[model samples]
Target: MFIREITHWFARRSFQNRIFLLILFTSTIVMLAITWYLTDITKERLHYQVGQRALIQAMQISAMPELVEAVEAHDLPRIKALIDPMRSFSDATYITVGNEKGQRLYHVNPNEIGKYMEGGDSDDALYNAKSYVSVRKGSLGSSLRGKSPIQDSTGKVIGIVSVGYTLEQLESWLNLQISSLLFPMALLLLVLLYCARRFSLHIKKQMLNMEPQQLSQLLIQQSVLFESVFEGLIAIDSQHRITAINQTARRLLNLSQPESELIGYAIHHIVLPEAFFYDAPQKNKKDEIVTFNQMKVIASRMAVIIDNQPQGWVISFRNKDDINTLSLQLSQVRQYADNLRAVQHEHRNLISTIAGLLFLKRYDNALALIQQQSESHQKVLDFISHNFRDHHLAGLLIGKYYRAKELGLELIFDPSSFVEHLPSSLSHNEWISIVGNLLDNAYNTTLLNREGSRQIECLINSEGNEVIIEVADQGCGIDENIRQHIFERGVTTHNNGDHGIGLWLVHSYVKQANGDIIVDNNNPFGTIFTLYIPFTREE
Candidate 1:
């Protein structure tokens, strides 16, 4: 019952204890597995090395001239002194010699000393023997044997040099290796178990001290609550000094950080392009402090509505880029709607002309006119069906296509280079921005150019798994003064209503697709915009 109670207490501990336990189990399992494998490899290597040493010792001792002479002389003392050190072998224990009568001259121990070495082909055999080279041992053991003999000057075998050792040495060495391997691993297991327990305890303490609800609340407040429930803020005071700031106010004025050399500096001095600040609001109503273009924005100020006016003038003026984007999107929608109205108007006019021709008794001519209209209309409808139908980015591309046409510029989609089942990583928005912005820029440049040909070419080709797109135009190639700044946001050569937004959008889309874009004036070939898009998202 006491053990059960302790188990229940452990189960009731915080979630982090469970995580730490999991880490401990997995890490220890992996570490011990690797340790065991390394131990086995070490043991095998040790046994191999010891076995080789025993074999070489046997060969070297047998090859000695004195040991050979002792065998030939049948001298027991000399033979015993030569090889008496290695007598513990359970399987192979034999030293042999061969004389001219095929009788043993001598051996190490008296049990086998002076025994005949038998069952070999010729008496000259032992003279030709080599070290660690095995031959059939016919005297005592069936094991492999090494033989080296003493020889006279006439190449006659004086006697045999014989030594025998079994694989029992390899077995004994393996046992010793196992002992050496197991001891260190057993000690490591003890230390590692203690480490796992201590690690779990430390992790449990840190988890017990944590409060997740409070941390989540902090992130929530930073993202959501801080924007609304605070000060009525204005970045500049009545005299245009950098008097007050909030999160939104600081963002509005583009304040620098770290060593803010421009702090307490005039707001107008730091804002981009000196022209924007002249029309900035002064002292106005509490709600209508700063006018970003025509949109009224309440500036950030101190928290109060006192003296029938703000206690202090705080304003939130925004950059003009937002205003321009909002306006352009609105214009695109409105202008596209207008173009549809015009298409409907043309259809009505065509119907009316055919009806009036029939009434004026020009039936044949009316029929011919109807056939011509049908062919032309069918061609356009077929083009739309073939090029855009079922395409993932069709709706997106069509919007920009119509917008380009509405601007008195042509968007020429190449007839021969249409693709189907496009790469899945290229999102709908990305395709739209890539195709739309490039086409829009080319159209704008073509309109601006006074050249003979006014054309904007949009080509898309899929090669293997990659997509290559090029947008070009016969516009007077980008002027040198602004060529370096063409793709940068808010930098423009001519800014009427098209406020330098397209090329930056193009740059962003290419980067998002894991791609690159090269902008080059085509010398005598116009402006060529190339985009290389990869087929996959590695991350």
Candidate 2:
């Protein structure tokens, strides 16, 4: 239960705090263990050295010829004179000389000279003639002493010599040794703790100061946002390997593999244009038309940068067909509005003429003028409504007719023009873009030739196995140098920046439908654009 509580408390701390505390705890334990081990070793070595010193002192004093002679003759004054000076110069706590019967002969304290030695440990030295060290309770206190037996020339044990250090003195020396190491050990421990703290903080900064739980939550949020977006999104690493791909991207690219299977694969495997990957532009490229998996897409690219370094790239794209559909709808609405405005303006002029005629009492001329205007409008409307089955295509033609008239150009539809239905191979929007762009180009071209006939002719026929559309304008013909590349993007005969896209779009739609286009010089200074698109009937 106590362990569980400690774990819970530690788990609640921040990442840096947890790391610091763990390192500090481990370092402290190791330092303590080391200090304990060193202290034990130092104490043992000091004890061994002190014991040897005492033993050596006893052996030296026992071997002295003067002490031996004094002990053998039982000369107290001589033994006193010899041992007293040695005791005063020695570091031993006490020194004593005793007879074989355990009677004290000489001592550091004079009063104890006549009395027997206090400790009973002298039996080994007197009886066995042994030189050894022992710990015993003596008159002074518990002490560590070394004893040596003194023998005369006959090898008879006559007296014993003992040199000792008290336990209290040994303890004091040991404490002094331990204090010496403690200071440096503590300093090293403080340095270790400081380094651990610094390392922990560096780790925390690398994690952006966010906890594991927060990072996990952020990852989940990013995943949700990535998948929920409408545009197709793909992320590649610096090595050009796929790191992330959303469902929309898979669908747009017509990939059936799951995201897991797709990830880590080379980005080139999906066959996106090289512009998105190789030698990428520093600035973000947006709304670029690129081909992917044989399908046109409006794509955008942005490099992923972190810490002032390029990490990878993120690409977002949508199918071009989808965008084109929307553009076509808007264009149709605008054309409808323009057509209404043009028709209104034409009616106002006719009304003014009819009013003038009626005011002058020319009733016959006014009625004739009204009849002629009605017939002309009705003929064109009836022809378009009867021949064309697709309302959008017919409406586009009617709007273009009025638009051309407003621009002071005569737009004529061939009498034999007929379209039973739109081609099944191409979308309605694709057809609309082709026809509208061609008519608009023709109108613009015809208006440019002020010295020539301002007439634009259009023919659309879908009776055969393929659909045919032709738009010829009486304008300055294509330049000899540019005629081969006339349908290419950014190639325009007009002096305006926006003049190039219309013909390019027309050519793209034609190519997409497996159609062929021909550009030729029309008679008497003009240009003709003809398109033939193959059609298949849907069962």
Candidate 3:
């Protein structure tokens, strides 16, 4: 089964699965974003904490009376001893005592025994802190500093005592805070994850318990909405095995026993000519009526494609008759479409001509020609188009010829002298109407006769005082049960989308000409329709 099958099988679900999915999506994103935010915030807080502790430690070291006296009296060894006990980080190489003027009072290293530390410069970190507070990256990006003013026995401030350390202390402090924070965040994440899994399982169960018929109904409803769809719908497994075939699929694929156990049969095995999957969305494919096994069918497939894998498909079918009628009607409508397109093309040319005339300042000639030749002429053309004799046979074949070609069915009509000369013996419009309807019906039947090869034969021969027009096809002939009723207004053997108008119209129009029409299944495998009209006897 595929994702679509899972969805379709449980279409009437309570949306539990979707809700769990939403929760999982939102929770994960929130967790990651918040973790990043808190981590950065904690790192900054830990950095500041390290700085504050260094200040306190420096104050304590500087408060030593011996160290303070050492700074004032410029005692180097005393200052080094006082700083040594306080120093911990090895990166803090040496310690120095500097005065209020940033002049070095004492240095643990002999090279700085009497060096004057520049007040604003960083030659001495602790001395600079007395006047200005800062953390600066040194020769090796590290600095922790503080300044403490020293006093003499008279309690007068004279020099500043300072100490310096490297940044390892700050790293230790940050890591401690980070390690402490991890435990709680991990707990929160685990709890949410546990909740998500539980919710997902519950939702999945609810979705699994849902019904599929509801989804099927919705699909049928959608079918009732669109027009001119050509694909034969085949709902099948990825192996092309049939599951549920629709009416269109039945006709297209010879799914005669619709209720039979067609569930596991390969679709290619069912229909003579196979239909293939199209890239259009499972729901958005063009619905065309195609012939299979010489039967007319509207076939389309709803393949369950997930992760680019085909699992199954939903095959839907409607009768070929509906499609045939629709195709015919669509062709009929095209008559007006061409005329409209022609008018637009003519209008464009007229506009261009008018623009050119105006540019040449032939204003009077342009206006008069526009009114008399363009606008007035357009109205006359429109009237002629409205009353134009559109193809008399346009409605007859319903363009079923193209469909016949697709099914490899042979459909031929005798384009004899009578086709063009029928007007001489019959009413021109009536001839168009009758010949077109009969031929169209022939083409349809020939395409659908799945039992054997199909062909059409037409012979318009004059016998005695009247002319004869016969339209015939070698097809799976009409059933004996429906033969008598074939000429009735609503008694059609096959019902898909047709209003059962073809034979009925043929009967009516032939009767109006005092002509007789008959259908005979003389062949072992197909049907033949013969039409006879009285010759217009010249008085």
CA lDDT scores, all candidates in order: 0.59, 0.88, 0.59
TM-score of each: 0.37, 0.57, 0.32
Please report the TM-score between candidate 1 and the true structure: 0.37
Model 3 segments beyond 4 Å from truth?
1-25, 88-95, 103-133, 153-157, 208-539
Clashes of 3: 31
Task: List the candidate 1 regions with Cα displacement exceeding 4 Å.
Answer: 1-342, 345-366, 387-392, 396-410, 422-426, 522-525, 537-539
Writing each residue's lDDT as its tens digit, candidate 2 over 382-466 gives 9999998889899888888888878888889999899998777677877888899998888778778877798899999999988
* Residue pairs in candidate 2 whose N, alpha carbon or C atoms collide under 3 angstroms: none
Q: What are the per-residue Cα lDDT tens digits for candidate 3 across 148-208? A: 6565676555666544555676667667877787888789878887898788776555445
Specify the highest-lDDT model's number: 2
Model 2: lDDT of residue 85: 91
Runs of candidate 2 with Cα error greater than 4 angstroms are 1-24, 56-65, 70-92, 95-137, 142-161, 192-211, 234-244, 247-275, 278-306, 310-315, 328-539
Residue-level lDDT tens digits of model 1 in 191-240: 77677677777655644545455556775775465356443234454445
True lDDT of residue 444, candidate 2: 79
